[model samples]
Target: MIHKLKKRRGIPAGPLRVIGSRAQRPGPAVETLEIVLKCDSFGTVEAVTTLLGKIGGREVEIKVIHSGVGDVTKNDILMALTGSRLVAGFNVGLAPRLEQWTKEHGVEVRLYNIVYTLAEDLGALARSLIQTEPEERILGRAKVIATFKSSRGSIIAGCEVLDGVLAHGRNFRVVKAMGPVFTSRIESLQVEKRPVREVRAGQQAGLKVTGFVDVRVGDYIECFDPPVGRRSSAWSPRGAVLRFDENA
Candidate 1:
């Protein structure tokens, strides 16, 4: 029986209506990132291909498959690099030397032990290529000096504004000698027992925190604003996508 060959690249074209007795080899999509699959078992390859095809839709093209670890060779990596494709493996681990070589040669490879995680990762990668996401930026820092127990069963941190201005009702993180311990918002702020909206650098203020209680006297406090949305545009980092090839 002759099966129709479908084009998965550029503008959609009608499937090639051909007539042949034997099955023809499937081709990777030219317009999308191609993926090569390596699995320990043939069944795993079939299952993963179906799952990825459903989740990735038309954004990803996974066509090459190696049924066993021994079937993987340098040729696979060369094909991947030449075609600008990614190689993914399931339970077919690569040797330490080969893994290092791939990294040094700038080959894109990832291993996954779970099926759903692979699909989710592929979907996320596809979305990231075209979607805008939010990223965080630090705004200010403070140092906790003294902790006072309030009558209302809450702990307040007497802090010295370190870097930027510390404002009331803003998000804050408590950093200990080891690392960050808690994150909360400032319930209130006061300077010398007088209520204030914000405290500038090198100033001392008292902070009432909500959603945390273990703030220590020597801990460092850091404040951060809400994450700002960043979209990938021609003028941004997303526009100049870098592709490295060590073999070049």
Candidate 2:
């Protein structure tokens, strides 16, 4: 014989209990999170990818969506953050319109005013995340990298390559202590008064910039390169910039 319990919603509702040798409850479903990395300059691609890979490995559900050099429009913002919890690595100064739109849409976005250099921006963003209070101020270095042309149209630069490789015809910045002073292109590269195709880490080289003039010694130089597949924990010598080479 079996006991018939009174049904409430097409089922018995009385203690509503189950009996078994071992009771098992379903585990919570894992969530799939996404992130979007938008970069305009090629120099930042590798460093940004390395940083994201590290973060992704630590967080099981998080994923990174990589975007290339281009304008970040309102549509891009909406699509990227539609179901994401965080947005980062966007240059607010270059996309003022998009920045305003993000603010209006109630999306949570972290704005990095510094541009072109991925490693520097990543370090800055990581530091900001640990702060107890959020500050509206945007922090960045003032040094700029510029390439100018001599009378013979040879590219000349009086700047320091802050990070990555500076190749011919690459885009760079001429910066002062306040912020970005100018945007220009590299016309030619010269090292030790000798013309060359590329400059590597710790090498002081001169460049011919397409735009602007009066390049100074103290100015910062930025370069663009392909994304790096791996990262090293080893610290480079102080004041030394990194140059990515597949063979090396």
Candidate 3:
């Protein structure tokens, strides 16, 4: 977006109104964003593309798949849907249906009036493409020493914590012969006959996990936390609205 430049070169100014509001975008994958660029003039197109090409900082990339010196066209929108699903412009406008199409099909339209703002926004979007997905982390591991039946005859795995404490209410994966059997959570943990919240490493305990009925003497219990949330971030949309006689 480069403001303070009034030379239109040979482009005509048309009836313009703000088009397309943003829709919910999914978490970007770890890849480059190939976008489409449309501008009011050839000069602006080259300048905007050059500005975006320098972004993404090696961790991600901004690749312009299509470039044209005209209003966004239907072909541009169709081209965007191939993968990048994005269209950007300078001094352009859009039609009503194009706005709906973007919201419906998850296409992004970015129209910039300032070149600096365009570079900054696309840079941030590129960085956001670096994946920070949710992940499960191991909390503890325990080795099953014996398999026993309770007074009511429900089988329980008597175990000694190999390392890390077996925590209550945390999810656990049952493993045996170096392979996973099933996943369940600690339903009960007991040292002797009294229920406890956790048992530490080097300690003997009887544990019951739901959905882990086929307990074996040599099976292992791996406790882990569920997948965590994404990293914190916030960004506001800049001059993204476009109004023109035609839409892509």
Best by TM-score: 3
Give the alpha carbon lDDT tens digit for every residue of 58-174 in model 2: 212334553444444444455455445334554422245555566665444444544434435444333333313222221112233545557753346655554457676666665
TM-score of each: 0.42, 0.30, 0.53
**Cα lDDT of model 3 by residue, 1-248, tens digit:** 22223224422233222222223235643357777777888778777777776776545767777777666755566667754677877677665566766766667788776677777777777676676667888888999999877545356789999988898898888898969988877888999978999988899898875554688888898999988778545332221344222234
Put down candidate 1 lDDT per residue, 40-134, tens digits, no spaces: 77677768766765554443433443223433344455546543446666665654456555655566666666666667665565444554466
Better of 1 and 2 by TM-score: 1
Off by over 4 Å in 2: 1-149, 152-155, 225-248
The TM-score of candidate 1 is: 0.42
Error of 1 at 67 (Å): 33
After TM-score superposition, the amount by which residue 236's alpha carbon in candidate 2 deviates from its true location, in angstroms, is: 44
RMSD of each: 15.2, 23.0, 10.5
Greater-TM-score candidate between 2 and 3: 3
Prediction 3 TM-score vs. true: 0.53
lDDT of 1: 0.62
Error of 3 at 120 (Å): 5.3
